[model samples]
Target: MHDTKVTTDVMNPDCIVIGYNEIDFAEHARRKRAEKGKSGGYHDLLTNSVLLGGERRTYMDLLNIVRERTTGCPSRLSAFELPSLGVAYLTSFLRRRGFSAAPVNSFNSATEQLREMLAGSPRAVAITTTYYVYDEPIQQIVRFVREQNPDVPIIVGGPRIQNLCSDQSPESRDGRLRPLGADIYINSTQGEDTLAAVLAALRDKGGDLSRTPNLIYRDPAAPDGPMLHTLTTVENNDLDENAVDWSYFDPSYYAPTAYMRTSRSCSFGCAFCNYPALAGPLNLSDLSTIEKELRYLCDHGVRNLIFVDDTFNVPLPRFKKICRMMIENKFDLKWISFFRCSNADDEAFDLMAEAGCTAVFLGIESGDQRILKNMTKFAKTDRYEYGIRELTRRGIATLASIIVGFPGETEESVKNTVAFLNRTQPTFYNVMLYYHDVLAPIENQREKYGIVGSGYAWRHSTMSWQEATDWKDYLVRNVNGPALMPGYGLSLWTLPYLLANGMTMEETVEFIKGASRLVIKGLDTDYLDPEPEIEEILRGLAAVRDGAGQGASS
Candidate 1:
């Protein structure tokens, strides 16, 4: 650790903010293949198969398209999109306070960038570290800032940190979650206030941090202990579209549409979800204000937008009003958002599609209703199927996110999920492994329910008011695997049943193939949908089979 005594005046004059995007291991692996004159890696093969009906595209064509879209900034453009959303939000927030904040994608060279940025100005650096790939680089940047300019404060925050600080108990701590690192840990959902206070502290403006809420920092003298400040609650106001400084963003890096946070809390309290605890209850934005924001995005040439709400479909009337406004105003932009499957219906689905909704993501959680109820999801199986079918029939793409492992999960339940997927025929399906946290806040309740902790919880699990921690590593490496004896037998039994229902044998093969690709490529399978084109190819195969059968008969 570097010293923290150097003043910002003596150091660099500007405040530099660095956000990390992990090293593109997939790109590196692809280069290795090319050097050896080999064909595509897993990601390339998977994407090509899914998007292009398994037809191969030249590497040069792929590279050119990426270059055109990203403006030659970085080859790992897709990975940067999500991080860019956070950076964009923070960038606007920081600028509102009259501070200069630059969003840098501190790949592997974060330390060098920090050093250079600090050389010219007495600067403070803020970085968001998420997942394991970011750990070393962020630590390096923080250490360098402390060593080179000790007074320059380095602060870190993100979902990873919020999860790590959650409760960890023996019963709850399974090896599934990853921990986060940071000097000041702010676990509040409203990060703008905490971020503002940090900037004020750096400037010696001496703001009342007690009102800032969600600010957690270490007293420099005491390394092990952290001090938590009382959080401030801000009322939702109708924000003017012109209030945000959009000019600071690089057009190439920013998504075409802006992400707006319409609410701060969630209504449904799912056990696996940390949203309710982090964001608190749902506080909605004024429908008129939301309409204005949507108009602004469309005016700025954004053809697509995404709502970052924890549950965009909650408050059914409010959602309908927003939809009516979009339709009435003739807003032509397509959008997607997350929704709880249990809360949606045919009427809601029709209204959303009428308002240019292209897609909606559903957190289906599990195929087993018992698992759903156990997780406090409160999702009804019949309603979920109805909602899915209604949305699909209306030409609205439905993406189902399913979690595989839960405390009461058996192998039979997993097969039930596969069977459910076959029946739904959702446009996209995402399978997530169950994560276990060592010290979860809900540990005591585990005994109350007579349920033993899986020794793992998500980052949102806490003990005694601690924040959530991520357990991705443990979940992937330990909790998830092929089914065991009883489960395997159930899987065997369910395979034919699924095919008999609606899922073709080819689709089942594709699902397994896609899962294997994820393990090999470390790429998300959610975005891959090679099914439509693959279906056409399969039809041709069936035709050929029928022709051969006719010939044999003759």
Candidate 2:
């Protein structure tokens, strides 16, 4: 088992940073979570169990759920743990500045795990609310921290904090902050420096945080309320200066892979996108620094990389140069990226393959030209086929991501999407029901689409949200593809992850086929009954996971 304990005193870490993951669990937390599991069906366990948020359960919880649904099923599944890149960066940046910090990666927020971390008694505790975490989990973490050490300041920051900063009134901010119960919130794109300053302030400034940039905190003494606001904006980090400190992560615990961002923000402003607005303007990393980071990863025994840049191949010249740099370095690494199908030439594909690109994720969004235009995707429908064909022809895997409903979506448009998929034939495909985020550019044009409601319940002119979901289910069941990966988190780095854990492309495809079958079966039922078919599929995955070599044929 990997060392689950945070080695605080070894480095005398100045702060403890916690990253919350809902399903993935560290080895130590697995047994504890499973022991808490109750008898239930697979779907019930999945939705009701919370590894961190929503329902609190882990893989062991899943095993218990499955066992309850099947006779003589195994007691456990192998651990699936992956560190958070954001948390890793924060830890590394702190350590690099002479402040020791320990990272508790893939934490499931179990009470025992919290006790282990609090045992170190670090100066401050920082929680990153990046992705997949909700209010219940945040409140839980904050409540426990206060219970253990009321005086120790709890700091919270991430995408949520960045978004909340848009409203600056003390009363308005206090109303929002009162529930989570954090002492501070950082609203900066790069909070490494701001966080460091906050830690230093806690030690040196008698708990005064007035000077920290991009910060919002509560001060009961203030006449305005308990929350005091600091408005100084912190500039984005110089990529070269803030390279990920890989020392904080275990190369083996993750999928022999690392997630890197060569740039920040996205260049294109697709109508459905909120990333560009949230991330500000595009900022590219220095090429020399990029080369150095690649070399470091190679030296550290990392076998693969997932470039997290929003448009990794944008500004095609820079893209080609990065490819060429990887080639020139003679690095022994395979990579994947979020790709734009347009403005790409044959040379780029060739260069990517030669540089060891094993797969790519294309956010194709829509198949019909009309839908594409309405979404402001800025990609030609024809070029998507060309890109998929070229990439697949070169032995590279492609994941085609689609959004079912947009403002202008119609039944005919849905058929066109299916036709487009059948014609192009990517290595994998996934369909998602469109979600209406208030911050997305599409919100500005809601009346144009005759939209009402918000989030998943949203509807526009040609289709209602429920229709989109039904169509999504239809596409998943009806579409013919090599594999249908889960549309959401699967794109969140699944290809490299599968490969990183030693599954061959063929093996991975088989596993996905089994998962797809389970999805189909789950959709057809209320998911309360014990299903032999689903049970059989689970056994096949378990066999593959245990290195039995072959997956059960679908």
Candidate 3:
């Protein structure tokens, strides 16, 4: 379905928000990916060799691994895919403030009608960014906006443009701003109020940006251009306190799935991730607020729901209560969400199943106990295994999300992971390589781990970036299950469409196994057909990895 919901105040929207550089899998891209699926074994290896640099690995080492049919290599086609929830969250808030907000989805999507929208003279344009991967597309979008409507104020936010830069000196931060040319660089995670205020002020034209809070902006009077302006840092402790209006987009315009979060921020301070720092602290929504939201979505014909909470089952008692509410209310919805192995209890899983939880994505970061410890997962590998086994037994499909290539990762640690995967064998597996974040928990103790550098481009004590990537490739092939390539994994927006339409986990695995290509669009989450619940997609991947490892040994 095309996104053609023309807003009433479209010509002069209080704000026109744009999200750019998303991987748009059209008919042609899918057809091309399907064709590459034909090459099978050679294609997998070649993809890995081409995508992963040959730094630490010798030419022969690379050649040998390629010959063995590595399972997890994300052919050169792999890239980062950001969740679209950010823009939705911002727009919902803007509307709550009684300001008109329209979304321009991507650079391509926006470029098509941006000039037309610009003609409408939006009070301001806000663009939310995610990973650094979107920098190129963001630059283009910003340049185009400036050229088309130079006077219209531009506001930018999201993880990629937050606190880390907010703390830097003006020249340093301006260095980043010089490329994008955004009028206002919003850098805090407590965005709802911050963004709404900016749009409200922009609507009044003479409002002081410096008075708004936690921003790096071009002061019109400043010589070097942008300067940091800090008001009280926004700390909206009440997670579910505000009214988040999701009425901006038509329900049918998106994929069948409707995603919600009962909480904001994560309490667990995993060293490798920067989310906790951004989110501030773990906080939950009042059950009443949740019921209201869920009932609203259901009333609007959104039955396939997913919670995008970093840890859906945390604050165990609250999660259980919500489940009961869903059951008692007879909420006609089937759902999927992320869960932590430590929090997966018998009652929780039972309530989830009864509440129509067909699937869960668990962050099973590593199989090695030491690696798990280093990652601060806290829970033992056995706990992870138990959670997986329990979920599967309850007829709940599980996708264990793994991140390989931590600072201290090694061959033996990966072997431990392989064994863990073989034992648990999740319905599907998603493996992503560890990337560096100087502001994350890992960077806090960089010297302890011998980490040096800004981004994932760092010097670790024991493992080179190349070596870490090699191990990641090893895990994907070694981990038993239908391992999804990086940036191409399933997303909340599409998960419900797949499940509600009868795309069983088994069929998804087989489709993945048979294709054997670098799938960026993720196993066609849009298409669906009925099949059995259980299958061995990971089994084949594990076998290939095992045979390859054995061949190399001999």
* Model 1 vs. true fold: TM: 0.65
- lDDT pick, better of 1 and 3: 3
TM-score of each: 0.65, 0.84, 0.79
Per-residue alpha-carbon lDDT of candidate 1 for residues 1-554, written as tens digits (9 for 90 to 100): 11111122323433465665444343433443353222112222322222222233222233223334434454322223332445566666677667666555444434565566676654466776543322555565566667776765666766655565455442232221212234565554455557766777657654334455555655566545444435544433223432344455543343354445677678876775555765556777888778776776666656556677778888888888888899998888677788766776667877899998866777887777887877787778777788888887888766667665565666566666766767777666544555443333344456544443342222222221011111221222232222111111112222323332334434433443433333323333324344443344345445555666798899
Q: What is the lDDT of residue 514 in candidate 2?
A: 51
Tens-digit per-residue lDDT, 473-501, candidate 3 = 66665554554422332332345655555
lDDT (Cα, tens digit) per residue for candidate 2, span 178-235: 7888888887776778999999988788878888878888784753466777876756
Instruction: State each model's C-alpha RMSD to the native.
Output: 12.3, 6.3, 10.0
Off by over 4 Å in 1: 1-14, 24-76, 105-116, 129-137, 140-151, 166-183, 205-257, 437-444, 448-554
Error of 1 at 447 (Å): 2.4
> Between 2 and 3, whose TM-score is larger?
2
Local distance difference test, each candidate: 0.52, 0.70, 0.64
| lDDT comparing candidate 1 with the true structure | 0.52
